[model samples]
Target: MIEFDHVSKHYPGGNEALTNLSLEIRHGELLVLAGHSGAGKSTLLKLIAALEAPTAGRVLVNGLDVGRMRRSQVPYLRRSLGLVMQEHRLLMDRTVFDNVMLPLTISSQPPSDAAKRVRVALERVGLAEFENAMPITLSGGEQQRVAIARAIVNRPSILIADEPTAHLDPAYAREIAALFRSFHAAGVTLILATHDDTLYSPYGARRVELAHGKLLS
Candidate 1:
């Protein structure tokens, strides 16, 4: 379980992203964050992964305080999470397999074990045959899939995506949506922030709207 207890995030230069917001997300819930740009949707997601700290209040994940975790603990916290941020951030020079394997390279897992896991992740994303392909060669939607594969290579229990279906055509968007659904069906805690009504409105199990950093509903 994750809880945001009266959380407020104030950036440098007096910009407040969130204001005394409190929310609770149970495990394995498909929660969608709905809002216009700058509504603090991304900020809310960042707090979960501890990419940003709250100026006031606490964010607790399974009884561990996110805001107060040490640097060494942050990596462990993130290992339990799969993140697909807006940017693909894939290395243009790297092969698809290499991109997915990057996460495991930091661990004590052996090369053979890591390689098998990478292959499994690629297979799940339906890109097993494209492991040798370069990111520069794939289409936008395929590139997004690669990013998703990289995120899940760690076998994270919780998945967070920011605008997962953005910038894709209708068919491609639908495909990606279905992919996310499969993950949810497999019992991964899915938290997605999207402005696309097709995704957040009729798609997610629960929808929470935000406006100017406050929950609207």
Candidate 2:
């Protein structure tokens, strides 16, 4: 459902983050992006999400060219995507319910319906009882679960997670990995960028590695 055609991304001062990186991610497929820091994995994800424009080439999501889409059109395009960053990005001052409700609120979903969806998402992440709790009071693993819940609350078709298990312990990392596996099995197109090979390698998903901004053969 996504394609990168000769895509290259360059930041300020002429630093190239990705170089001619091309790949296709099919619907309902679970893909793993494995690489060290500065290997272009995060840049690739941002390109797909339209958060960063490609300096050259094109990025297409569900047949629509993201690189060519209008700024106003981005929100509509992103409605189908669920993004989880390395940082939890939770609102520490807000309750879990409110944080998970943000996406739906942005979309102007009805309150009654949004609440039900948020409850389901929290349950999926095994945080059903913490809906009224504050983020600061939760454990690291619990906070990550809250982030996951917030991402998927809208029931997006594609899920992209960047370094999701980076700060968690081995057990919590495995828990998060297993949760992602369940989502994959349920037919969500998943692309996870992680430096931890052991966390996802056992899933036998198609693996793509990058080195110095280029895909490794």
Candidate 3:
């Protein structure tokens, strides 16, 4: 379970990203965050991954206080979480297979096992044949698929994305949304921050809107 207890995040120059917000994300649930560009949606998502710490209150994920965890422990905390963003963040120089295998390279898993897992993840995303291709060679939607494949290579329990399908056409956006639905159907916890609620509303996702750093609904 993920819990945010009256969390508030303050940045320098009097910028407040989030304010006294409290939320709970139960395991195996798909939740959508809908809001305008600066509604703190991204800030809330970052708190889960420990990319940013709260100025007040605590972020607890599976019983660990993320805001208070030592820097050395952040990576361990991230192992259970998969993150995708608007920017694919792929290494243009690396092949798709290598990019997906990047996460496992840091772990103790053997090379053959890691390679197998990477191929499996790519297959799940329907991109097994493109493993040897480069990110730049694929279309926008395919590049996003590669990013998704890389994210699930470790089989994270929670998958969070920030505006993942924002740049795609309607058809491709639906495809990506369906891909996310497949992951959720497999029992992965999904927390998505997106402007287009229609992408997941038909699937019965619970959505909470944020306005000016506070929950509006």
TM-scores for candidates 1 onward, in order? 0.96, 0.98, 0.98
Per-residue CA lDDT of candidate 2, range 1-217, in tens? Answer: 9999999988999899999988999999888998889999999999888999999999999999999999999998887799999999999999999999999999999999999999999999999999999999999999999999988998889999999999999999999999998999898999999988676678767889999899995
- For model 3, how does the per-residue alpha-carbon lDDT over 1-217 read when each residue is reduced to its tens digit? 9999999998898888899999999999999999998899999999999999999999999999999999999998887788899998999999999999988896667999999999999999999999999999999999999999988999999999999999999888999999999999999999999989898988979899998899888
What TM-score would candidate 1 get against the native? 0.96
Candidate 1 CA-lDDT value:
0.90
Cα lDDT computed for each candidate against the true fold: 0.90, 0.92, 0.93
Task: Give Cα distance to truth, residue 95, candidate 1, Å.
Answer: 0.3
RMSD of each: 1.2, 0.8, 0.7
Model 3 global lDDT (CA atoms, 0 to 1)? 0.93
TM-score for candidate 3, please give it. 0.98
Query: Which sequence of candidate numbers ranks them by lDDT, best first?
Result: 3, 2, 1
Q: List the residue pairs that clash in candidate 2.
A: none
> In candidate 1, which residue pairs get closer than 3 Å at backbone N, Cα or C atoms, i.e. clash?
none
